[model samples]
Target: MKILITGGAGFVGSALAIALKQNYPHYQVLALDNLKRRGSELNLSRLKAAGVEFTHGDIRSKEDFDALPAVDAVIEASAEPSVLAGLDGTPDYLINTNLFGTVNCLNYALKHKANFIFLSTSRVYPIKTIETLNFVEEATRFALSDEQPVPGVSAKGIAENFPLDGARSLYGTTKLASELLIQEYNEFYGLRTVINRCGVLTGPWQMGKVDQGVMVLWIAKHYFQQQLGYFGYGGTGKQIRDMLHVADLYRLIDWQLHHLDQVNGEILNVGGGLESSASLQELTQVCQEVTGHTIPIKAVAETRTADIRLYVTDNTKVTNLTGWKPEIGIRRIVEDITAWLAENEKDLAPILK
Candidate 1:
């Protein structure tokens, strides 16, 4: 089996490629990315060393799409991922990358008769109610629906069944639009497709920016001793998020692709679930434990727009179907990231944008 993964040089894409190569050697993995972002080259090198084929291209280019090798599956990982940055750029770029880019990839995959899996985000849900969920403040974080558990949803976090309609920012609007496109495509083309609305995804090679990958940013700040700001620190710096190891995420994708016939047009929430949720203060402690550094951080007066104060996915659907679970915990994630950074410190400085 051959697979084409867009944004293969990225943190999650590259890790997915490596995981695929290790687990399924018979499967040829081809990764395509524009390599426009910092640390992507290093990510590409990591994948190349793992024996995966690397291709340089943009997902928006028709020539690039036409150039890809025939494959049984296409994992659409490419995106302008920042929910915050979408506000600055023209709606055209947002439409092109988040909306049309996905349309183009789905078209390509359908033309080739390939299964598709999109790396969607939890931001597609409304943030107003999320921030307003009933919660009791803990020493470090907040707890939700404390009175009654809502089966798969309340116990786990945000379930796939959550309404997509509340007030959404520009980023969520674009993703929500694209997700509808994929759902429609699956119905029209009989193409097997699943939208995995992932939570915070972080691993060793992640190039975290101010707008995305907050967990890695936390670790990166400690690793570099860089100046850091805490947005919701007054709330105990306890904004919780379910962060998953990209390797485990690849396993879930592999399971879905192999069992596409069993499920079609399913919008699944993918993440570490409640088990992977962590607060900023907890993460800072992890950083302190990992780096042995009592890092100093400044607190920002306000939180960003569309910020989910405490939202985690209820990944019961995925676990029930695939029997896939995250093997690495948060502590392990911090340790692994610290170790990887320590070994690759010299190379890391160049990639810090």
Candidate 2:
């Protein structure tokens, strides 16, 4: 099978390409990326070393997709991925790349009769709704309130059916809009499209910036003794997020590819869930324990735009359907990222600057 991964040189995209090659040696994997992200260019060698073909191209341009040969499947993983995008400037680039880029990808898939997989964000859920989720604070993190029983949510966390009613930020708006377009494409053209709303996907090879890859950013900051700050929400740093390692996503994608027929047109909340969640404080403790250092962190009393309180993936649906659950916990996430950063500290010197 010939497969194309958009944003192929990115952390998630490159990891998927490498993992796919290892698991399915007979399949040819091609990755196309603009290398616009600060650390994206670093993945070119990694992808090439893994026997994955690389193309320096942007998904925002239809000509890039036109250059590719017909493939059996397309993994649409390209995006800006910053929730704060467009708040300080125009969101045109985010919309053009994420929403319109999917349109271009769908056109490419239609031409090739290839199946489509959209790597969407959990941010598609409304920000107001999430911010309103009833929670009580503990020593280091927050948990759901027993007084309120949110539909599609429990101690396990938010599910696919979580309410979607308010502004989800410019980044999320683009992804949700793209999802609608994908559904339309599937219905009108009978295109086999599957959507995975993933939350906090991270691991090695991630050139994490402040706006994206927060988990990786946290670890890198701690390991390198970089100054850290907790902004907004009184700077309590109690805001919670669940993390899922990229390797676990590889396992799920493999199963989905083999059983596309069964999972077609399905939207699953794919993530590490409550079992793998942690707060900034909890994360700091772990980093201190793992790296054995007191990483200084400041409390900035202003919250950033579009920042939410807590988000945990409820993987029950995907777990029941495909028997897939995250195997990498927060500790392993710290270990792998720490090891990768230490080894690639020289190569990543420019971005880490």
Candidate 3:
């Protein structure tokens, strides 16, 4: 069976492709990417080395999908993964890629009778709702107490059934909108599909930026001894987030692909869950532990308008369905990134800077 991974050269996509090739060498895995993301080009070499075929194509263009061979499965992993995406300017690129891009991918999926797997974002939960959740700020992070059960959250974190009503930011809206579209295709057209509303995914080869990829960015900043900043929410650096290593994501995807029949047409919250959750303050401690370097950090009371103080995936639904759980914790994530950077420092330092 051949699998097509959109955003194939991306951190998640590439990692999935490599794992597929290694575990199931007999099966063909092709990676289709626009290579538009700045650091995605670097993965071209890695993809080649993994024996995963690479094609340069954008999901925004229908022609790209039409030109590709029909595959049994398509993992729509492409996105403009930043909450502050459109806040800085027009959300054209984010809209075009995350929204229209999914349409194009779904169209391709329907045409081929292929299974569609969408890597949606945890940000799809409304910002107003998330920010309003009851919180207990500790020395390092904000957490939900057991007393008040948040509408969309629990001690397990944000679940799939959580309220999605308010403004979830433009980047989130696009993914949520795409999830709706994927559902339509599944119900109306009988296309087999699974939607994973994922939280912050990290690991090696992730080109983490300021607005997105906070985990990797934090690790890199500390390892390189670069300056970092904490913004908003009193700038205590206590805002929290759960993280999933991209490798753990790949394992879950593999399970979903093999069990498409049992899990079709379901939306699941997938992430590191409570065990892998961390606040920026806690992350700072982990980075220092991993890199043995104190990162220079500045703080400000003014925060990004679209930023959420905390988010963690409940992952209960997916776990019940597939027995999939994030195997790596925050320390392991930092350690992995730390090792990756140390090995590829000569080549990665410039882009990271």
Ranked by lDDT from best down, the candidates are 3, 2, 1
TM-score of each: 0.94, 0.97, 0.98
Name the runs in model 2 displaced over 4 angstroms. Answer: none
Q: Stretches of candidate 3 above 4 Å error?
A: none
Residue 159 displacement (Å), model 3: 0.7
lDDT for position 6 in model 2: 94
RMSD of each: 2.1, 1.2, 1.1
lDDT tens per residue, model 1, 1-353:
89998889988888888889998888999999888777788886688788899998887777888878789999999887887756765777667778888888998999899999899988888877576566667887766664432333474587887766587778778788889999999998888898888888888888777788777778878888877777853635877888898877877888887898766788878888778878887889889888888777888757776676787878888777667778778999999888888888898866552
Question: Candidate 3's C-alpha lDDT?
Answer: 0.90
The whole-model C-alpha lDDT of candidate 2 against the native structure comes to 0.89
Judged by TM-score relative to the true structure, which candidate is superior, 1 or 3?
3
Q: Write the per-residue lDDT of candidate 2 for residues 1-353, one digit (tens) a residue.
A: 99999999999999999999988888999999998888888888888888999998998999988788889999998999888888778988988999999999999999999999999999999887887778988988888764554576666788998888889998998999999999999999999999999999999988777888988889888888889998877888898999999999999988888889988999999999998999998999899888777877999988777888888999999999899999999998999988888888888766763
**Residue 148 shift from truth in candidate 2, angstroms:** 2.8
What does candidate 3's lDDT look like per residue over 161-183, in tens digits?
88878898899999999999999
Ranking by TM-score: 3, 2, 1
